[model samples]
Target: MTATQLSARALLLDMDGTLVNSDAVVERCWRRWAAAQGLDGDHVMSVVHGRQGHLSMAILLPERPVEQNLAENRAMLAAETADTEGIVPVPGAPRFMAELAGLPHALVTSADTGLARVRMAAAGLPYPELAVTAEQVGASKPDPEGFLKAAAALGVDPADCLVFEDSQAGIQAGLAAGMRVVGVGPRAAAHRPTVQVADLTSVRVTRDADGGLLVAL
Candidate 1:
C-alpha cells in the first residue's frame, strides 16, 4: 500500500483498542454484566467500546435509572482495573510511542484516570504525561468534548491535530472536533477515518522542519 501522509501540530490518542489491546478484559467484564442484566453479550459489546462504562450502560439499559447505571459503572471500572489478564500493547505500540517522544501529544480516552493507568501499565506502554480521561470530560466520545479538551491542553488548534482512534464513536468524535483521524485496527475501518491502518506497525511518524508531525500511513 502507498503510504498517505498527514501533518499535524499535535496528536490525540485513544487508549483501549488503539494503544492497548484490552479486549479480553473488557469483553470478560462487560459480558458478565450483560449476562447479569439478561442482555445479549454481542449487543452489549457493540455499545461498550470507545465510551465510558456508565454511558454504555445507559445506552444498553435505557429504562434503568441514571443512579443505577452510575453505581454499576463504578463497580465495572473497579472490576476491569483489578483484572489485567491478557492485557498487552497493540502491535508496534512501543515503537510508536518512542517516535512521538518530545512531540506534542496527549491521551484522550473514555477510561478514567485509574483505569487508564492500570491498563497502560499492564500493556507496558508509556502513559502520556498529558491525559484527558473520562473524569476530565463532561461528555464521552461522539461529543468531541474530550478531543477538543486535549487539543486545547496541548495548545494546538483543533484543525491542526490528528487523532488516533479504533472505534466508531472515537472516529466521529475526532471529526466533530475538526481534526483528521487515523483509524487503527479492524474495528475502525468501517468508520471512514482520514486514514486506516491495521495497527501502529503500518504507521511511521517523524518531526517535520516546522516542528510539527509528519505521519505517514
Candidate 2:
C-alpha cells in the first residue's frame, strides 16, 4: 500500500506533552499532590495527562468533597503556572510550530488560558491566535468539545482538521471530533492515532498550489 500524506484545512494541537515538554513540572506537581492525598503518585500521573486539573483531581481523589477538589484544582493550576523552571519545547516542537505560524492552526488544550499562557511562555512558544482552553469548553479532553470548538473557531469542518496530540485522552478527543489525529509521543502511539510520529519534528506541513495545507510525515 502507498503511504498517503494528510491534507487538512486547519491544525489543532494539544499543549502539555505535544507542544511543550513539561514533564518535570508536571510530575513534580502531581507527585506532590499524591503525597498530600496519600495516593500513589505513579497511578495518579497515569490518569492526569491531557486532563483538566479538576477532572484529574476528581479521578484521583474521588472520595474527597467536590468543593475540596475544586479548591485543590485551583491550587494545582496556580502551582503549575508558577513552576515553569524546567519547562521547554518538546524536541522538534519549536521548529514545527514556527513553521505553523501564519497557518491555519490553533491550540486546543485541557489547560485553562492562564496556565496555557504561562507554559507556552516558559517553552518560548508563540501564543496561538485561536486557543480553546478548558475554560471555553463544557467538558475537557476525552470529550470532543474542545477540538470541535477549535475547528469551529477556524471556520473549518472537523473532517478538514488535523490534530496533534500526545495523550490518550487527547487522541480520543481528536478522533471523536472527526479530525485526522497525529499521535505525537510514545504514550500516544498506544492510542492508535490515525497517524503516529515520534514527535512533531518528523511531520511537515506545506501549502499546496490551490492554497490547501498538506501534511506529510
**Consecutive 10-residue window with the lowest summed lDDT within model 1:** 202-211
Off by over 4 Å in 1: none
Worst 10 residues of 2 by lDDT: 1-10
Q: For residues 135-192, could you state the per-residue lDDT of candidate 1 as single tens digits?
A: 9989999899999999999899999999999999999999999999999999999999
Model 2 lDDT vs. the true structure?
0.90
Candidate with the greatest TM-score versus the true structure: 1
- In the range 32-63, model 2's lDDT, one tens digit per residue, is 99998889989999999999988888887777
User: Model 1, residue 217: displacement in angstroms?
Assistant: 0.9
Residue 56, model 1, lDDT: 94
Question: What's the true lDDT of residue 77 in model 1?
Answer: 94
Question: Best by lDDT, which number?
Answer: 1
Query: Per-prediction TM-score, please?
Result: 0.98, 0.96
Shift of residue 130 alpha carbon in model 2, Å: 0.6
